[model samples]
Each structure stands twice: as structure tokens, then as C-alpha cells.
Target chain A: MISKVLVRLKEDVLDPAGRALTEQLNHLGFNEVKSAMVGKYIELNMDTGDREKQKERVQEMCHRLLANSLIEDYEIIHEVIEKKP
Target chain B: MISKVLVRLKEDVLDPAGRALTEQLNHLGFNEVKSAMVGKYIELNMDTGDREKQKERVQEMCHRLLANSLIEDYEIIHEVIEKKP
Candidate 1:
């Protein structure tokens, strides 16, 4: 099983890096860009095949190490790969 | 208009950061985690509402700034938000 996690700052949190990117984009002539928010995308390959177990474990991973609950929010997407015979 | 860009290193490219993350996860008792890959997720808010133009501009942004063609690949997802009266 594979899990892809997207961890981003909360709406209320200030993102200086994002602001910098937005400004750089404008300077580069991408004037249509109003703003930019940068985040982390993590892909995990897990040994577990059980969907429920995978979800629970991934959620635990996020809560423990992947994201800071005080200012960041995360979403997990799971993908199951079939083993070839 | 909004565009979400996911930038990741190509499979052929080695990712030491991802390997270190996987090791850390294992050390932290996430024993089910076999491997990990880290990437960037960027959200862009654009002033233009035209979907086609938005796509083209975003692709240009990715090519020119967001992604490194030599080692990284990027995918863009666009969303259109209706303005409230």
C-alpha cells in the first residue's frame, strides 16, 4: 500500500515562503498569480495491505511526526498496488 | 482560478532526503513504512478565471520556475471558484 500525504499550513497561519514565491512569480512576469502557498508532499510505501490498518497507521504518523497540529493541516490519500504473479 | 502543483524528483534520481525520512520514520516505530519520497506541493491563486489560459500559464510557471526539467517532474491541477455576489 502507498499513502501520499499533503501537509500545509492552516489558513490563519502566515506563510512567508509562500509570499516570497508569489512576489518572485510576479517579478518573473507571472502577473496573474495573486498568491502562492507552499507545502510538503510525502509518499510512503507501506508493507501493510489492510486499508483500515494503513489509514490508522498513516494518521498516527502524521500526528506524531509529519505535521504540526498547531499550525499545519494534513490530508492523506491511499493507493493500493496489486502484486504481479 | 487556483492551481495545485506537485513537484517530485524523477524515479531515476536519488533522493537522500527521502531516504533519511524513511529511516527516521522507522526509528520512530513506524515499522510498516518500507520507503518514502518527499516532494513539493504548491498552491497558486490566480486572478484570471479562464481555465485554458490558467492551464497554459501554470504550465509555463512550472517549466520556468517551479520544476527542474533535468531532475524533477510536475503535475498541475486547476480549480475554479465561483465569485459570490
Candidate 2:
């Protein structure tokens, strides 16, 4: 199975990284660019027959350490792959 | 328009952060997890009536600054939003 987590700062939170990118974009003549945001993309490969259990475990990982729940939001996407013995 | 760029380390490169995450996952009891990868997700908002031009500009941005072409790969996703004006 493959799981992907995308974590981004909350709208209210200040993102200096994002701001820096936006400025760089402007400097590069992308004047139409309005805003930019920088975030984390994590990909995990795991083996588990129980889909529900895998989802729960991934969520726990995100909340416990992968992301700061107070200042960021995360979305998880997963795909299950079957292996032949 | 909104553009999302996902930049990830090449398979051959060593990712200490991903390794650390994998270890943490194991400690947290997700033993089935085989590997984990950490990457960057960047979002940009721009206005360009010319889709082709916008795409080119975004690609340029990725190659020039958003991603390290030598050690990373990037994929861009975009959406165009119409304004009521």
C-alpha cells in the first residue's frame, strides 16, 4: 500500500517560506502570481491487509509527529497494492 | 489560476528525513511500513489567460528555483478559475 500525506500551514499562520517564494516569482517576472504556499509531502509504503487499520495508523502518525495539528492541516491519500506470493 | 508543484528526492539520493520518519513509524508500531519519503509541496496562484504561456512559466519556475533538477523531480498541477469581472 502507498500512503501520501500533504501538510500545509493554516491560513491564519504566517508562512515565511511561501512569502519568499512569492517574492522570487515576482522577481522572475511572474507578476501575475498573487500568492504562494510551501508545505510538506510525505509518501509511505506499507503492507497491511486491513485497509481500515492502515488508515487509522497513518492518521495517528500524522497527528502524533508528522504534522503540528495546531498550525497545520493534513490530507491523506492512499492506494492499496496486492502482491502475489 | 492555481498551480501545485510537488518536488521529491530522486530514488538514488539519501533522504535522512525520510529514514528518520520510517524509524519513528516503526517505533509507533507501524511495522508493516517499508519506507517513507519526505518532499516539498508548493502552491502558486497566478492569472494568465494563456494556458500554454502559464504552463511554460510554471515549468521555468520549477526548473530554475522550485526544484533541484539534479537530485529531485517535480510535477505540476494547475487549475484555472474564472473571475466575475
Candidate 3:
């Protein structure tokens, strides 16, 4: 199974990196860009085939190691990848 | 318009940060995790309503600033966000 985790800052949190990118984009002539936010995309390849187990493990991973619960939110999606014969 | 851009390193490239995270996950008891890869997720809010122009601008942003064409690949998705009444 392949699990994708997207971790992003909460709506109320200030993202300085995102703010800088927005300014830079404007300076580079992308005046239509109103704002920007940067987040983390993590892909994990797991050896398990059980969907329920994969989801559980991924959620645990996010809670313990991937995201900061105080200011960040994470979403997880799972996909089953077939092995190449 | 809202544009989501995902930028990830080419599979041929080595990702030490991802490797370290994989190892950490294993140490933290996620032994089923075979490997991990880390990528960037950027969200941009644009003032335009034209999907084609938004896509073009996002592609330009990726090429000129968001992603390194030599070592990374980017995927873009556009969504129309409704304003509050």
C-alpha cells in the first residue's frame, strides 16, 4: 500500500514562507496571485496489504511523528500499488 | 481560482530527508513501512476566474520559481473557490 500524507498549517496560523512566496510571485509579474501557502507532502510505501491496518498505521505516524498537532493539520490518502511482475 | 501544485523529486534522485524519515518511522515501530519520499505541496490563490490563464500562470510559476526542472517534477490542479455572499 502507498499512503500519502499532506500536512499543512492551520488556517489561523501565520505562514511566513508562504507570504514570502506570494511577494516573490508578485515581483515576478504574477500579479494575479493573491496569496500562497506551502505544505508538506509525504509518500510512504508500506508492506501491508490490509487497508484498515494501513490507515491505522498512517494515522499513527501522522500523530506521533509527521505533524505538529498544535498548529498543523494532516490528511491521509491510501492507494494500492501493484507489484511489477 | 485556487491552484494546488505538488513538486516532488525524480525517482532517480536520492532523498536523504525521506530516507531519514523512513528510518525514524521504523525506529518508532512502523516496521511495515518500506520506504518514504517527501515532496512539496503549494497552494496559490489567484484573482483570475479563467481556468486556462490560471493554469498557464501556475505552470510559469512552477518553471520559474516553485520547482527545479532538472531534479523535480510538478503536477498542478485548479479549483474554483466561491466567495462568501
Between candidates 1 and 2, the TM-score winner: 1
Kindly list the interface RMSD, in angstroms, of each predicted candidate in the order they appear: 0.9, 1.1, 0.9
lDDT, candidate 1, equals: 0.93
* DockQ, model 3, C-alpha based: 0.87
What overall lDDT goes with each candidate model?
0.93, 0.90, 0.93
Q: List the RMSD of every prediction in angstroms.
A: 1.6, 2.5, 1.4
The true-versus-predicted C-alpha distance at residue A10 of model 1, in Å, is: 1.1
TM-score of chain B of each: 0.90, 0.89, 0.92
TM for candidate 2 is 0.88
DockQ for all models, in order?
A: 0.86, 0.79, 0.87
Candidate 1 vs candidate 3: which has greater TM-score?
3
Compose the digit string of candidate 3's lDDT tens values, residues B9-75. 9899999989999999999999999999999989999998788988998999999999999999988
Per-residue lDDT value at B6 in model 3: 83
Model 2, residue A27: displacement in angstroms?
A: 0.5
Better model by lDDT: candidate 2 vs candidate 3: 3
Task: For candidate 2, write residues A1-85 as lDDT tens digits.
Answer: 8998889999999999999999988998889889999999999988777789889989988988899999999989887776799
Off by over 4 Å in 1: A82-85, B82-85
lDDT of 2 by residue, B1-85 (tens): 8888889999999999999999988988779889999999888888777888889999999988999999999988887777799
> Model 1 residue A79 lDDT?
88
* TM-score, one value per model: 0.92, 0.88, 0.94
